[model samples]
Target: MVPSDGTAGRPLRESIRDKLRERIIEGTYGPGDRIVERDVAADFGVSRLPVREALRMLDTEGFVEMLATRGVIVKKLSRRDVLELFDVREALEGLAFRRAAERLTKRDATHLGALRSKARKALEAADGPALHGFNEEFHDTVNRLARNDLLASILEPLEGRLHWIFRQNDRPDQLWREHEELLAAIVDRDGDRAADLAVAHVRVNRDRVLSHLFGDHPEGTAAAG
Candidate 1:
């Protein structure tokens, strides 16, 4: 369902890249799913050159794997890979929350509150996509409030992967509740509490995903036992 010709101002290759990435994120192109260049090019009504260039960009971004024989497929993350990403996210987002708490403005607090409210409504309605979108907006707002471009650059890709994981888990209620708690801490300007909650939230999600992947005993607990 990628747009065929809506990219007026942007470069064709970049537009194609974004469309493909969006499809991948929204589960249209799932992990290990083949990305045929000809099909993509035809879908987008573009030449193969732009499609290939777009795929190369995605390959460099670790979204897809390119092979000589097998061609291109969506990159599949292992359990270890997800855990490692969670570890990084815990550290980075914990820092982001702390910093955001220190500099949280009334405007930012109001925006976050609105986002939380919207997310809650989405959750109540059982609208998964809307809830996910609002969840991202909430987190992205926090990242922006942190006001660190470098941190944003590092966290953005991780967030993308996390979104994919979240979609797979199918449990948005707890996540929305966590977002509510996080916003409360941020609004209170409690940096320490905010940071702790952020880390714990990441850990909670990590456990949820791992548990879903590995049955009743997650890899971490099984290893420790």
Candidate 2:
């Protein structure tokens, strides 16, 4: 998350980009919604130049389309896109977890324990923001412990996409339990168990999300509508 104010006293363009990108990801600016550079500039109380730059960054990140006549519109993820992203996520995260389990230190284990504790507290409190933040931190820390920056880089965007989906159908208690189970495997240095747990965790969530989105759930029952 980029801060709004940079060290130089002006609003950082990266901050504006982050805010806008989040909106796009969370569907605040839904598919086919035209994003006017001037309007975003006014909304952020910044200049059009910075807004354009932000839009460019978003385009590069595959979050928006620079249309022929419409300028910029929010990019929509098709069902295929969602499936593909999560498929890649499952495999990559599995590999990361296995690597992490094989190499986890006492310090890494302790840090993960603390994160799990915080995640459980957030679940008990039903604090959505805290749960989301802690869950993200837990996954990111696992990626870091895997000692593969390339894997971390690849997972970053996929994690962002997956977060809102998880935030939808995932009960806080279930999330806490899954985190703890996964952590237990990693801390035990059970590489195969950790990898299996990681893949199962993601796959279960993926199925739940897909069901909520397209199956026997009530209309619009999953995401924050």
Could you give the C-alpha RMSD of every candidate to the true structure, in order shown? 2.7, 4.9
lDDT of 2 at 194: 95
Per-residue lDDT tens digits for candidate 2, residues 79-153, read 565566667878798999999999999999889888877887788788876776677677778889999888878
Which runs of model 2 end up more than 4 angstroms from their true locations? 1-12, 25-34, 68-71, 168-172, 216-225
Best by TM-score: 1
How does each model score on TM-score? 0.89, 0.80
Best-fitting candidate, scored by lDDT: 1
> Per-residue CA lDDT of candidate 1, range 1-225, in tens?
444453777778888988888788788998899999999988877779889999999988778999888999999867766777777888899999998999999899888877877887888899988877777777878899998899988887676676677665667776777888988999999999999999989877888877776653444632321
* Cα misplacement distance, residue 123 of candidate 1 (Å): 1.7
- Tell me the lDDT of model 2 at 103: 92
- Total backbone clashes of candidate 2, pairs 3 or more residues apart or in separate chains: 0
lDDT of each: 0.81, 0.76
Candidate 2, residue 92: how far the Cα is off, in Å:
0.2
Evaluated against the true structure, the overall lDDT of model 1 is: 0.81
